[model samples]
Target chain A: MRLKDRVAIVVGAGQSPGEGMGNGRATALTFAREGAKVLCVDHNLKSAQETVEMIGANQGTAMAFKADVTKEAEIKAMVADAHSRWGRIDILHNNVGVSLSGGDAELLEITEEAFDRCVAINLKSCILAAKHVIPIMRAQKSGAIINISSMAVITTYPYVAYKATKAAMVSFTEQLAYQNAAYGIRANVILPGLMNTPMAVDTRARTFKKTRAEVEAERDAKVPLGKKMGTGWDVANAALFLASDEASFITGVTLPVDGGASVRRG
Target chain B: MTRLAGKTALITGASSGIGRAIATRFLAEGATLLLMDITEAVVEGGEPTHKILDVPFFQGDVSNEKDVDEAVRRAALPTGRLDIVVNDAVIRIGKKLTDTSLEEWNRVMAVNLAGVFLMCRAAVRQMLTQEIRHEARGRIVNISSQHGMISSPEDVSYGTSKAGVVYLTRQIAADYGRDSIICNAVAPGKILTGKTGRAVEPRWLDYSHARTPLPRLGRSEDVANAALFLASDEATFITGENLMVDGGWMAG
Candidate 1:
């Protein structure tokens, strides 16, 4: 019961059409399991509802909200809804990301439309959520923010928008942490590499027209540890550690849950 | 469930400060423990950690290869396996580059850098013989410092030694990943270990507070909690990482 009585808001708390749990859903569940009452937010209402039901089966407290995060109004409403219900927010977990599904491509092949959408979804959503949540956390004088960036920030990735925006997240977190430390707000980012999640694998398989096994194997071979891709639980666990009191002293760190791939590059 | 259940662990410099805290945390988490330090005396003062925890204590210098090997050998005798090793033994001269003598520089490096190498070597040898458990044959956590990545203000030798530690951690992880050996470091920033020294001096304390973003300095428990995470099965995919437990000092 590390997060007992705490109120957590998990953005992008739904999985796309795929075979495995996504980072946001797993993190939402992990927070509930540790005694935090979680607010699950996603664009897909049904998927968010499904996650809430799973938490309910475990006798954990949770609620679901539908919001298109790229819209500033929805992000603001989502924060207000959680605050009005719980009176205070203890944690904020941002886990939304998209690549192939978002129509991302190499620099030459990328379109202006695709670039704008990626920035709107991946970058703008996180900033607006923080902007709305900071006031409540400041009044409370305590909060933890865990942003899910990507290992593509450091490693070689073909997509420009994903890499550029993800890299900005690391900088944004550090600035956020420095600015809000006096208010007792801690912000850190997790860079997950080659995870076997619905968004990570299924989107690639469909867009690239490759078999699921082929995509998994290709990503697995790139990892330095166990020669296997990590699961959604890996990202969830890191988020849990950062969100919990165990990491109270830690802030503004760019932690890579990359199976040692980032280290190999150094 | 205990996170460290069924694991056999060895912690160096276990008599005081961060090491003592780590030893206590691991034991409570169900690790079969061996506490190694050059002495039984606690720096912050009280009962010896081994006696308080009721674990075996080995009084030996980490710089001595024979002493390191002996500690590792005895730690494995009870279970025939050493699941984790924490290199926390460290010495600091607190001298400026010009003020530091050759003798002063050598002592710090011997205990800080070379000592980690010896203990890690012995532990890895034992780990290589054991079967993999929880995606790791063995795990090593070296207590590093934010000073290594940045400047240590005035302590040159100490920072240089710690920088070596951070690099050594990466090399070991890269070489041993195929063997399922995991190695990482926990970098703490301005932790107040309740020891009386230059660390607690008003000027230094004020300096740390000015540079650190958090309202207060860190406690030994903060570093211990992080070490526990890296040593536990929960950190399955992480390796060759130097996780920071600083309250946003390095971030600034």
Candidate 2:
């Protein structure tokens, strides 16, 4: 009941088309389980509705809203919808990101179109949503903004767009924290490393033409702890911490939920 | 459910300040506790933490390896398992490099760096024997300072020792992750831990406020909150991290 009665807008609160849970859906469910009234927003309306249904099944308060977050008009409408429903938005979780599914690739091979799409989804969406929500938060004098980045920002990654956009999000979060501290608003970012989410493993398996076991084994080998890939619950737990009053004094921090991989930064 | 229900936690430097704050937070979350410090005297002139909480208090300096080992041994006696260890004993010699004498420098290193190393070694040794729970055999939270990453005003030796603490935390995390022993550090910046004297002096306070980006300075509870998060089950996947509960000081 950490987030009891709090109004939360979880953008990208939909699972990818595959096996395990995605980070966004896991975070939305975690928030709901802790008593947050979550607005599950996703480009895919049905997927967002599915997340809402899961929360409903658990007797949690939540709703699904459809919006391609990259569009400013839709982002504004989504924020307004939540504010009109709840009167105040206490938490804003920006959890959208893409790599292979968004056609991200090595520098020379990536197209401008794919790069722009990743930037829009991963980076700009966060900024635009914050732009719309900050005023409401400022009026209320309190809010918590949890942005999901990746361990790739610090650790080496083959793709360019995700690395660059995720890194920028970190800087943006810091700026948001310092600038808005006077209003009692806190902003922080979580960098998840090789999570065993549908988007992370299933997409890799599909792209590489490998078995799920093969991809899981390869990713598990990269993790230092338990030699196992972390589940969506790990990232979800972190989001819950950052969103709750337990982290009241924490702001502008980059927490890596990467076991110990980021520790080996050479 | 309580976050730390039925867990056993041992915290050093628990008489006052950040360590004392951590003790109460852990206790409130259902942890069985053993507190260790050089003396039971509260620095901020309040009742002793162990007496108030009715927990066992072992009085010994962390710089002494025998004391550290004995404390670890006794901490596990309560539940036959040491689930969490917080290395927070520190001695600060706030002098410029040129002004610090050899004796002062050695003393800071002894209680800061060597003390953390000994406590970590002892805790890890005892933890290696325990079975894993909540994806971890044990968790170690080292209280490092933000000064170690950036400059610590006039303090040189103290900052160097804290830098060692950060490095030591990473080393333990990297080497022991396979053993399911989670290790992390909480770096606090300008925390006003209800202490008076030089820390709250106008000149130092001004410097702290200038560097800190938050609307207000930090409290001991601020550091405690971050420490509790790292020590609990919520942070199972997080290791080798130096989490800054600085209110954006380092980020600034």
Candidate 3:
């Protein structure tokens, strides 16, 4: 009931092949279950439909839409479609990100094509989505933007473009919050660390040709709390708090959804 | 629907302002509550908080080790465990470093910094003996101020104490992660809690307005809501964080 009657749009509402829930799917479901009507957007229409179906099974309100968030025109149309369907937008969640699968590499090994794709998917997509959603939120005079970034921005990571683009998200979110506070739009960023999601653990397993258990065990050892990795539900719960009225006075914060890893670093 | 059902909690400075709001929210969330304050009287002028909530009240100073230990003991006696503790008790001298006397500096530090230490130590000691629930032995939510991260204008002692609080939160989280003890702080910005005197002076109000990016100042409930989040199971994985409830003030 925290988000009762609100309208939310969750971008990247699908995960690459995985066993359990992804962050965006979990967030979209959490918001819907809490009474928000959700529009689930993803480049893969079938995947977005699957998330919508899950919500439907639980008697939650949600609809699936397709969009390549990196394309400005597609992002604009997605926002417009959501606004038209719901009549107003109250929340925008940007959760698209990719690393090795997107052809990312260390600085010298990285290709121009990989860098551009990384910037487009990880950084520009968020900016473009916010650009299209801000005016509608300004008219409504109340909106919450939750951008999903990675903890790799602060910690060591191998991919050059991924690190740079993710770091830029924190700065962009701050600027968005600074300029839009008067408009009643609150913007915040979440830095997820060593999550056991399909996008994180599964991707790493496939990329490194290791077993899922092997990848999970390796990541779990790095986390300080219980020596275990966190779940997508953990990130979903944090997103729920940031998006709800409970966080009315909070804005422009970079909350790390890590298991004490960020604090215990030597 | 109750988020904190079956949880026993102790909240200090529960007589007024943000503490009172936090006490109210915790009750609504189905927590068995014990309130402690230096006095029964509310600083912002209202009925005593414990009487209003119809809960048990422990009158004590947070800086005193005996008072802190007794309060924690009383809070845990009913349920044999303390699930949540919010260190909201703090005193501000509101004087610049050069203008502050030794007496003024000592009072603020004792109430703000030393108080947090005493309470956390007692709560952690009790928590170490309890069974973990929902992946946590206990959760501590310390009420820090945004002034700690930046300058507090003229209030040097108050800001320094709050800075210590932020550091202490991180240290506790780092040390106690293996014990399932979660500690975090909520830093409020320009909150209007109906407090009078130097806090609401026209000059200070003007300065706050200029710094805060939001159109309006914050309410006590704003801080309380955040405290409730950190206290609840919703924030199980988050520790050692100083969450800013500053309406984009720090962002700018």
DockQ for each numbered candidate: 0.87, 0.81, 0.86
Backbone clashes in each candidate structure, one number apiece? 0, 0, 0
Error of 2 at B20 (Å): 0.8
Query: Over the stretch A1-266, how does candidate 1's per-residue lDDT look in tens digits?
Result: 88999999999898999898989999999999999999999999999999999999999999999999999999999999999999899999988878778988999999999999998889888888999999999999999999999999988898999999999999999999999999999999999988999899998898889999999999898888888888888899999999999999999898989888888883
Per-residue CA lDDT of model 2 for B113-177, tens digit only, reads: 99999999999999999999989999999999897999888999999999999999999999999
lDDT of 3: 0.93
| Lowest lDDT 10-residue stretch of candidate 3 chain A | A257-266
Local lDDT at A68 for model 1: 96
Candidate 3 lDDT score at position A167: 97
Each candidate: RMSD: 1.0, 1.1, 1.0
Per-residue alpha-carbon lDDT of candidate 3 for residues B1-252, written as tens digits (9 for 90 to 100) = 488999999999999999999999999999999999999899999799899999999999999999999999999999999999999999987788899999989999999999999999999999999998999999999999998899998999999999999999999998998888999999999999999999899998998899888888999999999998899998878889999999889999
Chain A TM-score of each candidate structure, as shown: 0.99, 0.99, 0.99
DockQ of 1: 0.87
Q: What TM-score do all the candidates reach, one by one? A: 0.99, 0.98, 0.99
Weakest lDDT window of 10 consecutive positions for candidate 1 chain A: A257-266
Docking quality tier of model 1: high
